[model samples]
Target: MIMMDEIVLFNPGDSIGNFHDYHEAVQTAQIYQERHTESGHVVVVKSDNGAPSFDIFLAEQQLDNGQKNPSTSKRYTISKKL
Candidate 1:
C-alpha cells in the first residue's frame, strides 16, 4: 500500500476531477463554484489506497429572520481512474 496525498474537485451533477496538487484542486473548485454560483469544496485525503474520500458540504446561509434557506451545494469525489 502506497501512501499519497490526493485532491478532489467536486462539480455539479456528481462530477469529479482528481488532482495530485492541493493548490490546483482548490483553485479549480473555487472557479467552478463561483461560475455556477453554488457551494463546493476541496478535500485532501492522506492514506494508503486513499480510503474515505468524501465531499465537504456547506449549509445554506441563514436569513435575517433566522430562517435557513435552501443550499445549492453539491457533492464531489475523486475518480478511481486518477
Candidate 2:
C-alpha cells in the first residue's frame, strides 16, 4: 500500500482532460474508485516521493489557517472551517 506520508499528487485529469482543483480532483478519483470497486476491480499501487505523491491523510479536507507558514510560525494548527 502507498504510504500517505511518502508523497503522491497525481491529478485525475489526463493530458486530454481539462484542469481541476483539489475538490474536483478528490471527487474525480473517488468516482473512479467507486466504478472500479463496483466492477470487482482493485486498484492498489505504491506512492512515490515526488510531485505526483501527496499524503492522503493530509490531503483530506482540513482547513488550517492557524497553521502558520514555516517561515512565520514554528508550531500551530490551521483554522479550518468545520
State which candidate has the highest lDDT.
Answer: 1
lDDT of 1 by residue, 1-82 (tens): 9965343322233334445665565566566566756453333322123543333222222122322432432223332221
The Cα local distance difference test for each model comes to 0.37, 0.29
Best by TM-score: 1
Query: Candidate 1 clashing pairs?
Result: none
Please report, as a residue range, the 10-residue window in candidate 2 with the lowest summed lDDT. Answer: 73-82
Q: How far out, in Å, is residue 30 in model 2?
A: 0.8
